[model samples]
Target: MEPALRRAYRRESEETRRADLIAATQELVAEGGPEAATVRAIAARAGVTAGLIRHYFHTKDELTRAAYLSLMDGMTAKGSDALEGVGAAPEERLAAFVSASLRPPVLDVGAVVLWAGYMHKVRTDPELKTVHEAAYLAYRDMLQSLIAALPRSASDAQLRAEAIACNGLIDGLWVEGSILSHAFAPGEIVTIGLRSVGAILGVDLIAHSAMLPDPGKILP
Candidate 1:
């Protein structure tokens, strides 16, 4: 092969390898917790050699860190997509944002455990801490803006505080919804969460209670 052709072939091969590595990380993390997403497991899932993973990521932490960022990126993208064109009302938009942010491409227990493990790492890893903080801050700012757009029933400062509180409520509820057994279906957690937060924020959410689906009977 010509020199240029050989170079192009190598570039394509490198891209494919990188894609394989990332895909493997995503699969393992979505199917098992962080521990199950070891370099060995990722390599096996990718059908690549462990040496290849080592070639791309020198340490397990490095691989996990990359996977963590990827997971956040995916969630952010989906959440943003969910909020698009959903602004008929401040309340509606806020609900759209929260629902999008909580729901994910994968809803399995292993995926929730994987997220929790990465969240734990981000709480301590300085390099990853800022990324996690920024994501949360983005969500908080969005909710604050939505609340700010509401009627002037409260002062700006009061609204801001309420927004922050609302965000805290969302954070706690999202974790609960993600990990809790599927005894309750999607949106059930959201319903209970919205009611609780609405009471805290002095908002009237009871009217939406009728919109909530029944917590279906537990299956065998």
Candidate 2:
């Protein structure tokens, strides 16, 4: 192959291998949690040698991080849809952000399970903790901007404090909704979360309840 063709071929091959590894990781995590997404198991699923995973990821930690990021980045890409076609009213946009953040894509069990597993790991690993914080900051910034667009005036400190509280509440609800399947009905989780969050942020989420997901759709 020519140099350019060879480069293109290599890029395609790498992408394919990366996709294979991610798919394997998802399956392993869903079936056996994060611990099962080992290099040996991933390689066996991908039909590649364990050395190939090493070639792409310097360490097990690196591989785990990559897998976690790939999953989360894919999920966060939907953030754009939060504002799509909605009139740019601050409250409307804020509700959109809240709804999107709280709702899990329950259509795919593997995705949901892997996401919960990675989230659990982030609590224990320093690097993953940083990554998790950065992701939350990005999400909260969107909410902050939407709040800034509101007509009501508030001090910067007040707004930041409210945003932090709202984010924390949503994050806790997410973990519970995603992991503790037996404890609460999905509907109860969303209803209570929306009500409490609305009270804390001084926004009436119930009025714009159309944006909220029906808990029936949220159960995988």
Candidate 3:
């Protein structure tokens, strides 16, 4: 696609313009992966020049890193929203976090497409790997906090192991829910994932069953 010149960017705040560029990158990546999200393509989508993108981000890698971070930040923030409710029981909050991971917005197809587009690069790209690791650690820390809030206290080492295992369960179920939505009934993935993770953490998620979702509500 050819780049379109837009004078409107001249009046836009730096932050706004930067966000536009990142959003453009996400759109392209979601539609056709990195090869299609080239600087030129991003510029076209954002209606900005390649030079302007360089001004905000020093290099292509820098911009891509920023975009990838943006993608992850939005996803994890929404995914962790169930933990944000005030005064909810720890068990319920835990269930919310699991449900968030397997529900809409958090389990969106476009977001999953963007994530898959970046997954291969994160392994070999140093900057991207750094971003991915930081996101991963932050999520694990969030899980640790949730686990620590439980009635039954756990040792630090045990909590760490449980966090890792629980995160694995969430991530794996996330893949299935996003790509293979037909395999399980609506909300079933959330139920199964929470049960599996509750087992790994020795936390009775089922006992907190009142907090879990009603299957009929999550229908596609």
Candidate 4:
């Protein structure tokens, strides 16, 4: 192979290995909490040597942090991706995003486990705490932007307040939906989320929910 081609292949291989390690770490953490994701266990899960983890991450804490960040990023991306082809209407976009968030794979038990597993560390570790805060801010900021785009006029302070409330509502629903999924009927969470958010924003999000690509598809 040409030198450039060889280099590209090597880089891709390295990244793939790194991702596999992180995936293994996340799986272990979700299954048995953060304590289960030791370097040796991660290596065993990934089918790689423990030394390989050192090649990618300086320490176990570093690897765990990366996994946490990846989990949060994946959740955020799911909500953002739902906005695509959702039309230019702010209400439609917001409703679609909320629906996506309340359903799988964002609303899965494993994802919630991964999040909960990291919470203890996030409290004691400054770097992890920063990651947690940044993730929260980013999610809230996205919601704030969506709320701001609505036809209703609101000051910056009001928008921020609404975003915080809406985020809290969604977070609570997501946790309940994940932990006690059998408690709610299909589409119940999504319906409640839209109506509650609508009430908060003083806009009928249910009216715009029809704009979703397949409203019945994600209602779990």
Candidate 5:
């Protein structure tokens, strides 16, 4: 075993272990809120000793904060990944992004539960609140970029305003669809989201979305 090879292996192993701990924390938090994700419970869930958590995170709060950020980052990645292979049309790309956000994985029950579980801490803990605000800004920035790409000319202020509005619309629909999923028909939230967002941006997202070779592929 060469020194370089050994170092690479050790780094990979450490990252894998850290990821496992974060996964365990997210699962416990989702299952029983933040209180269930104690360091002991996280270690047990990850099949590691409690002290092992200290090696990766300075404290339980740090670990919980990491899990929350992981959850939020994953959601943003899901939406961004939806843009892959999408055409240059701004409307199509925006529609795909919104649809991806409103559908499964991003709109899953467990994900929402995990987010809600951390709400209290995010509100009171200054560090966690900073993370929450940063995540929100990142998502909103992405929305603003997508909106800026549209055909119609808009000033920075207008783009920012539209992005905020669209973000709120999507967030509301996402929460309702996740918690009261049964209350709405399949694809209802997606349709509403596209229409509402399209109206805000002064484009027909549904019509543009339909232009795709297989609209159902993204919409579903």
Candidate 6:
């Protein structure tokens, strides 16, 4: 069978090509929707033959699924870096997580656009549902672990409740902050988040201000 027209591949490592394809799909979906990331469109945007997509991904749906995961992975990958860089103290790690979530890239409007675009598909598409469910749990579980690790006295049920509360607080603040980035000063989200979640979990987040990844960057 003849292949569709696309630009020739330039020098790129295997990982780079695959990442490029996934990223191309994200850009397309972010600009339009899931329907915009057709194989041909992805190939043309990636500057590679459509066959190359098949080489990396067996089907267009597979490519889309990979792209969906790519977006989800990007959400957490930076969180991992921020946590690791700050050392293992529970308060510091929690502070880092709070600050990172409320900062740029995470707090920007583009992230909200991409997430809302795919959120509808998650309800109807099984593959996307699995990705969404798993990622959501993973994030919540990370919070659960952090909540449990905090140097406070709490039971299993109490800790789980605290984690769930923190998750909701973060999610709500993320959307509201992303959309209204102009309204809140930089770091305001972090301050408000830690304060709110701290009350939810009975932790003194303000005392941990020194542990914040970006301290006092928020202005009045």
In model 2, the runs with Cα more than 4 Å from the true position are 1-13, 106-116, 119-124, 180-188, 211-220
Candidate 1 deviant stretches above 4 angstroms: 1-20, 29-36, 49-60, 102-108, 153-160, 205-220
Stretches off by above 4 angstroms in model 3 are 1-10, 207-209, 212-220
Cα RMSD to the true fold for all candidates: 7.9, 7.4, 3.1, 6.6, 6.7, 3.6
**lDDT (tens digit, per residue) of candidate 1 on 1-220:** 1111111123337667776677677666666555567776777677767797788788877777777766666665665665565545655555555555555553345555667767766766887787777766776777788677654477878877887888788766666766784766746665666566667666644443333232222112
- Ten-residue region with minimum lDDT total, candidate 1: 1-10
Give the winner by TM-score.
Answer: 4
How accurate locally is residue 143 in candidate 6, as Cα lDDT from 0 to 100? Answer: 79
Runs of candidate 5 exceeding 4 Å displacement = 1-12, 217-220
TM-scores, one per candidate: 0.68, 0.74, 0.88, 0.92, 0.91, 0.89
Worst lDDT run of 10 residues, candidate 3, spans 211-220
The TM-score measured for candidate 6 stands at: 0.89
In model 5, the worst 10-residue window by lDDT is 1-10
lDDT of each: 0.62, 0.68, 0.78, 0.86, 0.85, 0.79
> For candidate 6, which ten residues in a row score worst on lDDT?
1-10
Q: Candidate 2 lDDT, tens digit per residue, 26-60?
A: 77777777887777877777777789788877887
Give the TM-score comparing model 1 with the true structure, all chains together: 0.68
In model 3, the clashing pairs are none
Per-residue lDDT tens digits for candidate 5, residues 70-125, read: 99988999989888888999999998889888989888888888898999787779
Residue lDDT tens for model 6, 1-220 = 2343354769898899999898888877887888777888889888988887888889987877778777777776666667865767788788777777777777778778778888878878898888887887778887788788988799999888887888889989999999998898767887898788878877776677676555656433
Ordered from best to worst TM-score, the candidate numbers read 4, 5, 6, 3, 2, 1
